[model samples]
Target: MMIKLLAIGKTDSTHLQELISEYEQRLKHYIKFELDIIPDIKNVKNLSEVQQKEKEGEAILKRLQPTDVLVLLDEHGKQHTSIEFSNYLQKKMNAGIKRMVIVIGGPYGFSEEIYQKAQGKLSLSKMTFSHQMVRLFIVEQIYRAFTILKNEPYHHQ
Candidate 1:
């Protein structure tokens, strides 16, 4: 299965970008992985919170194919241990899932439409994180999950 991470806005911090790139390279050894950044909305300050999310949601939904399994990285979503996450990924591959699309929404979070379209939701932690930081966290966790699956020494229990 191909794993794709779609996040709103760019990672402006050079340090963070370097870290994300490191994991991106590591992920290639295990599976096809891509991180696509949806550029931030122009003149967002003028838009209402709901308006911004609606606009972002439209862009988010556009990136998805009907067959892709859409998972949102939501705070209120299910939390999984590292092993459980790896097993979840294994099951998707076992089921022949084509594209596993995980999205990290904008500041105001997802719209109703986006929520309706998602097949599942996952939470990295109960605490909130910057949208930019979440990109790095998700990528690293994905890499770690694959290493765990292969019994690699990268992940320590």
Candidate 2:
């Protein structure tokens, strides 16, 4: 199954982008992985939080395929250990999923429409993180998950 990470805005930190790219490369050895960055909405100063999310949500929806399973990275979502996450992904692969679209929402979070479309939500941590940092964390965890699945010496119990 293909894993697609769709996020809003560009990563301003070159350091973070480099690290995320590293994991993206490593992930290719195990499964198809794509990091698609949606351009940030313009003139956000003029729009309300709801409007911003609606616009971002519209853009996000447009990128998804009819068969794609939508998963949102939400603060209030279910949090799983790295091992548990690997098992979760294993279940999806066994189920013959086509493409899993994981989304990182805008500053104000997702819109009602986006929430309605999502099949599941996952939380990396209870604490908040910058969107850019979250990108790296998710990518690395995915890479680590693959290593764990392969019995590689990357993750420790």
Candidate 3:
């Protein structure tokens, strides 16, 4: 199945972008992977946190297709081990899913509408990381999961 990562805003740090790209390139060997960045909202200084999330949510939802399996990277979501995540991905591929869309919400997190649309939520860790850093983490973990699935030497655990 194709795996897509949708996030709000660009990765501002050149170092982080390079790292994200490295993992993304590694992931291409295993699946059709793409990173979609939803540009940050304009004039957000006037909007409240909730309002910003609502606007971002609208943009996020617009990128989704009805058939795509939407998974949100939420702090309160289910946490999985590396091997377990690989199995979860395997199950989706086995089920013949066309695409698996994982979203990393804006700083204030997801809006209610986005929450309602999601099929599942996954947490990388209890500790919070910058939205940009989360992009790198998730991409690397995805690459690692595929390596684990294929019994490659990339993942040491």
Top candidate on TM-score is: 2
TM-score of every prediction relative to native: 0.98, 0.99, 0.97
The lDDT of model 3 is: 0.95
Per-residue alpha-carbon lDDT of model 1 for 1-157, expressed as tens digits?
Answer: 9999999999989999999999999999999999999999999989999999999999998899999999999999999998899999999999999999999999999999999999999999999889889999999989989999999998897
Question: Candidate 3, clashing residue pairs?
Answer: none
List the candidate 2 regions with Cα displacement exceeding 4 Å: none
lDDT of 3 at 17: 98
Q: Pick out the ten consecutive residues of candidate 1 with the lowest summed lDDT.
A: 128-137
Off-target runs (Cα >4 Å) in candidate 3 are none
Tens digit of lDDT per residue, candidate 3, span 70-154?
9999999999999999999999999999999999999899999999999999999999899989999999999999999999998
lDDT of 2 by residue, 1-157 (tens): 9999999999999999999999999999999999999999999999999999999999999999999999999999999999999999999999999999999999999999999999999999999999999999999999998998999999998
